[model samples]
Target: MIAINNLTFEIGARALYDEANWHIKPGEKIGLIGANGTGKTTLLKLIVGDYKPTSGTISKSKELTIGYLNQDLLSYASDKSILHVAMEAFDRQNQLHTEIETLLKKLETDYSEDLLNKLSDKQQEFEALDGYNIEYKAHEILAGLGFSDVDQERKLSTFSGGWRMRVMLAKILLQAPDILLLDEPTNHLDLPSIQWLEDYLKNFEGAIVIVSHDRWFLDKVINRTVESRKGKLTVYAGNYTFYLEEKSLREEIQRGEFKNQQAKIKQEERLIERFRAKASKAKMAQSRIKMLDKMERVDDVDDDNPSVNFNFKFTKQSGRHVINIENLGKSYPNLEILDHANAVIEKGDKIALIGANGRGKSTLLRIIAGADKTFTGKSDTGYNVTQTFFAQHQLESLHLESEILQELQTFAPKHTDTELRSILGSFLFTGDDVFKKIKVLSGGEKSRVALAKALTADANFLILDEPTNHLDMQSVNILIQALQQYEGTFIAVSHDRYFLDNIANKIWYIEDHKIKEYPGTYAEYEEWQNKRKLQPKTAAPAPQPKKEEKKPVVQQPTEDKSKQLKKLNQDLGRMEQQISDLEKEVKQLETKLADDSIYSNANKLKETNSAYQQKQSALKQVQQQWETLAEQIMELEA
Candidate 1:
């Protein structure tokens, strides 16, 4: 447990926190939520004792171990592999293991009984600490964080900064400290990796406080939210969804109270003014005026809304067929990226392309955008298909010397200076921010500016690769809203689940060396996945014994008993096979349903759905037969 009392932190003239009091209870999952510059990260530093508060005391139990993961501070040495870095969490265990090994060597060299006993005790302690399984545990954590088997052996220098953050997260998880402080933990994770992390955190025994702009991740992980706003911290006892609802409700109540107080003050002032004009009620008037003046006025709430609006107005419309890909293939010598892929995109289609980190989602986007032509694919843009490709590396590709506004102006020539500034303002760049050089911008700021430029291009078809990367929740929501309202076709690869849920009508799952399409929302995809997981596997039934040949046979009415027995066995076999086949078919249909391409093909999907229904009906019939056969088999065995 950690407690902060009368915390007041100031940097120069700005007071980041004023008499702020907060406590993180044991086993609490708290999400630190706030705007870009609201001191969320600073508060984490305060809690971790990295920064001394200007005035206040931060108290914690001496026995409590704290682990803090700052995204920016995470780095890996060039020579170290991902697995090696992750294994650093078990340094103490490794040391103990080495000592145990040394003791074992000593025991074999005619050591005394007492010395052997000491060594035995040491081995017991090491085993109790799970020293033997440390390597396996470390590998599991790394793999869950998205490290491939090959990546585990590769040098740390081979990975990018984002992947380096994942290594840090893996280390933190493996450490298993009493308290965990995570800053943008999900920034480097893809959808599957994020899901894995959510499961990990859900089962984590330690207290967790995370600073993340990922709303959906927060909703799934954190149970409480601490919002930093206007130099103060407000705690809400719930997840992100509850926080949003409660915050809105509180704001409405505050607004009502403020209005009522204002009305009362106005009425009192009017009465005082009228009484002041008359000599007879001068004392009453003076008293009323004093009461009115003495009343404390409520401070105006800070405007949470961004000042500028982002309105992307395109100049032209694309043809019905926005983009067409025919036998698209890419390879790097021995490595094949995309193989014989074909897709036809239409206008007004909001498609989300998803896969693991090394999958060909980005490569496919590039081929469609015409950024890469060395592939064997013929990507043809329809007539009037003005396209803009927002690459993942767009921020790094910007000219460092140009100012933020200047960069936008250069890319979007049709936009006036005023229009460009407004767009930048909506993305949280304003006044002096617009004048800041592109090189000086933070990763998040640079990403926003790149997105602004991409949106301003007036493209009918937008191919964006991880557009939500480095963006805060508000900025991401703004982009989602804009994309949802846009009349153009969109093909984007993003890890933000909430963004995809809001903006995408279909999803293209790039897995198993192929692009599969799925219709419906992300929620539907999850439901489909859960159903498949819950489905029972097909298992071979236990063999039955043949009918015994007895010496004494009871004479019963003449009936075709042999024929009946044969028919029963055949029926049972057919029922079992039918159920097994239905299970397999259902899995395949669910997989096809989750595919975006299959959903896009209406006729094929309709047929698949019809077949799926027929399978379900057949499964019901087989299930009835199975129950009957099971009873019959039990009776016969008896």
Candidate 2:
């Protein structure tokens, strides 16, 4: 566990964290969330000692091990195979294996008892450390992260930055440190890999703090949430959804207190004025003034979630059919991206094209956007189909000499300055941030500017590839809301499920070298896909065994079946009741922990937190049991 006490960190003249305090408990999963420039990643770096705080201390036991995975690791290059790079986490076992090999070679000439004993010791140590299985473990993790068996044997330097980041992740996961600090772990992962990581991290023994913009991922993995705002860290007792509700409630209370304090101040000021004019009450008036001056004033809450009324004003509407692709065949020398793939995009169709990496999502987007002409099939754009395509490569089109506000002005010339600024603000460029030159912006910043520009185009159709890549949760929400109000046709390629579910009416995926369509939202598509996977596949029937030689039917006893069903139903009922009771207890404990008084009393806070966590664990166990029992009852009945 690590404790950050009164931590203060500054960049240049601005303070990122001002006396922020947070304690990371053992075995706890925490989601550190905030806007883009807030200090989520900075806190992780502070814990790992990569950056030092200006004041206060991050305390932990000397023996505690830490593993950090950040974007900076993308520059790490090695000639060794990815498997070898990951297996390097097992230092002791690898050393023992080398020693054992050396001893075996020495025995080929002089077979001394000392050499034999040394070899035995080394082998024993290696086996004790599970050295032989390390490679298997490494391979399993790498494959789970979307690496093929053949790719594992290739040199790490041969992979791209994104793939190399995956290799770094594999190495960090293999390290199995006491606490894992991941900054946007899902940024480089496709949908399948993200789900695999979610499952793996749920079963991970160590504590983890994830700094991510993926709201769905946080909801699936984190038990607690921490927000960094106004140079202070505030704890939310639950995940991202819970934090939203809790923060709203807290802000309501804060607003009420602020109003009441303002009224009280007015009353006190009137009384002081009335008494100050009287000779007899002069001393009382002075005392009242002192009291009012000493009172702690409550500050009103700021509206961080702004409502946008800026509409996307395009010049012309597209025809009924936005795009039409026929027998689309595209391939490279060693890879076939698409073959005889055909799809139709109609107007008003907000399509979400998604799949694992190495698929043809981007290529298809390019073809639809008319940026690629190498395909072997026909791709036509509908009438009056003016379009704007947004991708990572689009950043090159931006004028580096222009400022953020100036960049928006060029693309959205019809809009007022205030409207353009509002759009930029929604993308997290606020105040003087809009004045920064495009040349000085980082990749993420440039992505935001590009996305803002793309969304403001006068075209009737949009083709977006990974628009949510660099957006924070709030910015993504903004984009979702904007797209919801958009009347133009669009086809977007993204792995962000929340974004897809909120924006798209159809799901597109590539299968069997042909484009497939699911006429539903991403959530509905996921549910259907899951049920499809669970449905039993039909098998060929066994040859009718010579008419009368058929196997006799094995009939189960009615009494035993009835008893088993009854027991399962009874157990399920009990589990449901227990789960309900535990849920109440955990809620009550959470309320107790939320009290300001408890924080002032350390012992009370610790005891309440411990009880809350225990009840949560118990609730999870009983809920799982209830599910198992219900499944059993269903199977028996069937």
Candidate 3:
């Protein structure tokens, strides 16, 4: 348990927290939330002693231990395997294992009773500490976080930053500290991994304090919500949805009180003014002024909800079919991402493409955008379809030397500066912020600018890949509103379930190298998928015992189809295992792609690109095989 009493933390002259109080009780799951720069992460650090408060105390019991997971841990690197890294959490067990190994070597030489006795004692301690099962525990946690057994054996330094973060998270979970302080833990996680974490944290025996902008995650995982706003730590005795309702009611009550107090203050001032003009009533006015000065004036409630007004109009209109894909085949090394897969994107289709990481969601987005033309298939756009694409990588394309206003001006030559500033304002950049150079802006600021450019492209079709990355909750809401009001067709890949649910009318997911569609919102898709998964499993009929004399026999359609489908699925599973390796390799290559040393050099970039293409080619070949096998199964079923 930890108690923060009258805590006051300051940065320079500005107080990030003033007289804030919070008590993290045992087994309490708390969601720490607020706008950007609200010090949510700082508060967690304060609790973990990373930062000292300007005043007041944070009290914790001597037995309390904490496991903090932050963005900084993404830099963690080691030659050791991830399994070994995670096993490091079991300090005593690991120490005993080392000591036991040393004793075994010693006994081979001395063979003394004293040495044998020490070895026996050490073995007992190790067994009691579950030393033998430490590796298995580490593997289980890593698997839950989306790592395979083979991946656990790979060096930690070989993983991408996101995967490395997962390693650190696994290490923390293995530690089983008394409390967990997770900062944007889901930022690097895919949907399946996020769901796995939700389940794990739901049953976690210790207390948890999570700082994330993911509304759906908070609503599902936390029992309490703490808002770090207006330099105060406000507590809501419920989850995010409950906090919204309760905050609205409290604000309504506060508004009434504020109005009443304002009226009383005006009346008092009027009386004081009238009495001051009269010499005979001067003493009475003086007394009233003193009383008014001492009065406790109620503060008006701040605006909690801000509206966005943007009319995204395009000069051209797309045809009935926005896009059509046929016999699409894409691969990367051993990963058969999409093999002869097919899908159609009709006009007005607001689709959310989501799945586990490395599922080719981003890759598909690129193919749709025509940015990557490596796929072997037809990806045709409808008539008069002017399109815009938004992705995390586009942030690097911005002119760092240009001001925010200038960047938009160059991108939207037709729009006036005033109109551009208005668009920026809707994204929470106001006045002088538009004048600041893009180079000086933070990642979130650059993201907003990039998004603003994408919206003003005057395109009827949009292909957005992870557009919500680096955006805060407010910006996400603004995007949701802008997309809601726009009359355009778009497909986006995102892990933010709340954003997807609000903006998408259809869900698109890739499975076994094929793109599948659900004509419903994300929530509905989840329900449907869950039901499909929960369907009762029955054993498939075995092949009729060997036919006598090699005679041809009629086959049962249902049983034959089931057998074929099962075989096809098993093949897909084997391919997926191979994909695990290629996925990691591709991620490593991508991490290299983001490196300045590689991209800044033409030769190195060319070499990396060539190697990348080779891997992709290999993956596509395997993916094509998937289509071959799948087609056979489909034929048998037909």
Candidate 4:
């Protein structure tokens, strides 16, 4: 656990945190959220001791181990297998393995009590730490993260940067430190991988503080929220949605208080001016003047800037059949990603394309966007369907040497510099920020620039791939609202369930080389999938003597099924116990909270309140898991 006390961090003349105070508790999951340039990553560095606060202290528990996963992926030049890299997380276990091997060799050479004792100790420690299961767990985690068993043995250097980041992430999760600090851990992950991480972190025993842009992931994984803003930190007792509501109320209250104080000051000033010359009232006027002078001015509340005003100007409306594809087939030299695919995109259709990674979602988008002509498919756009394609790597298309303003001008050649600046401001780039070179901009900044340029294009149809990849939560919401209002037909491939749920009117789910169209939002599609899963199976076939002889073939599957059920039952028991323990702790905290004297101490009150909330959150999570397991057990029994 770490405590940030009166922390003041500054860069040049800008104070990011001005005497900000926050407490991080054990076993609490917190989502660190803010807009770009709000120092979320800087706070993580401060907690990890990589950066010192300009003033004040970051006190940490002496025995706590903190694991930090930075945005930069580890680059391995050596031929270390991916599994070996993950296994490196357990360095102590590896050392014990080596010691035990050496002791065994020595015993074979010459028997000695010392060697025997050393071997015994090392073996016991290894078994206690589940050393024998390390490799199996590593593979299991890798598979869950979308890496195949064969891929685990491949050299780390063979993987893409995104996949390599997964390798690093797997290692960090294996370490299981006391506090996990992850900055944009979902940046490189696809949808399935993000879901896997959410499940893993939900059951993680230690504290977690993650800064992520994925709203659904944050909502599912974190119990508390912290916002970093203009020279201060604000803590909310619940997740992102709760934070939004509480923050709005807080701003409203602050604004009201400020207005009231200003009115009182104005009244006092008028009274003083009117009574200054009256000798009888002069003393009273002076006292009122002193009171006004001593009153601490209320600062204006901070809020988001005006929402970006965005509207799509269509060159021409597309025909009813906006896009039509027939017998679509795409393949590499050794792999056929898509085969005999067919689909149609009607005018005004807002489609969300979703599937596991490498399932041809992006490839299909490319074919439809006319960016990939190599595919064997009759893909065509309808009459007057001008399209603007924004790929996942679209930011790379920005001219790195050009300023943001200049790039915007390139797209809108007739617009004057003043007009360009106004448009740039709409995308949250104002003042000198527009003058920054694209090379110097952060990923989020570049993403905004790409989006701005995309908006300036003369197109009626949009094809976007992972459009929300590098955007912050606010920017994503902005884009979502903009798309909602746009009249153009669009197809977007995104991992953000929240965004898709908000904007997608139709779901085109890609799986096993085919696209299945569902006419509803992502939430509706989820309901359909759940219902499909719960349908009963057909009756079993009648048994025969020859079928009995084939029992050996099916016997292994039954044993594996039994093992899985046993594990689930064990997990259920553990969760039940955990829920009971957390309930007790919550009661204890509530008792302490009832002590009115603690409210007088600001630090004690904050700590006690945070502890109680954390306990309640932990209990809720455990109870949810318990119910989930109970349902699964019931289904298995049935």
What lDDT does the true structure give each of the candidates? 0.82, 0.87, 0.88, 0.84
1 or 4, greater by lDDT: 4
Across 482-531, the per-residue lDDT of candidate 4 in tens digits comes to: 78878889999999999999999999977667666777899888777666
Model 1 TM-score, 2 decimals: 0.81
Model 1: residues with Cα > 4 Å off, grouped in runs: 76-78, 275-286, 307-311, 397-403, 430-439, 536-638
Candidate 2 deviant stretches above 4 angstroms = 274-282, 430-432, 537-638
Highest lDDT model number: 3
TM-score of predicted model 2?
A: 0.82
Q: lDDT by residue for model 1 over 25-46, one digit each (tens)?
A: 9899999999888899999888
Measured with C-alpha atoms, the lDDT of residue 41 in candidate 4 is 94
Best of the candidates, TM-score:
3
TM-score of each: 0.81, 0.82, 0.85, 0.80
Residue 427 error for model 4, in Å?
0.8
On lDDT, the stronger of 1 and 3 is 3
Candidate 3 per-residue lDDT over residues 1-638, each given as its tens digit:
78899999999999999999998899999999999999998998898898999999999999898999999898777999989899889999888888999999987789999999999999999999788898888888899999988899999999999999999999999999999999999999999999999999999999999999899999999999999997899999999999999999999999999999999999999999999999999999999999998998889998755667658889877755577777789999978889888676867999999999988999999999998899897787765688999999999999999999999999999888878988999998887988999999999989999999999999999999999999899899998998998899999999999999999998999988999777789998888677656554543544664756463343566567687789887886677455545544654665677678776789989999888778767766765686576556544543
- Candidate 4: where are CA atoms >4 Å away? 73-78, 272-289, 414-422, 533-638
lDDT of 1 at 587: 55
Identify the runs in model 3 with alpha carbons over 4 angstroms from their true place. Answer: 537-638
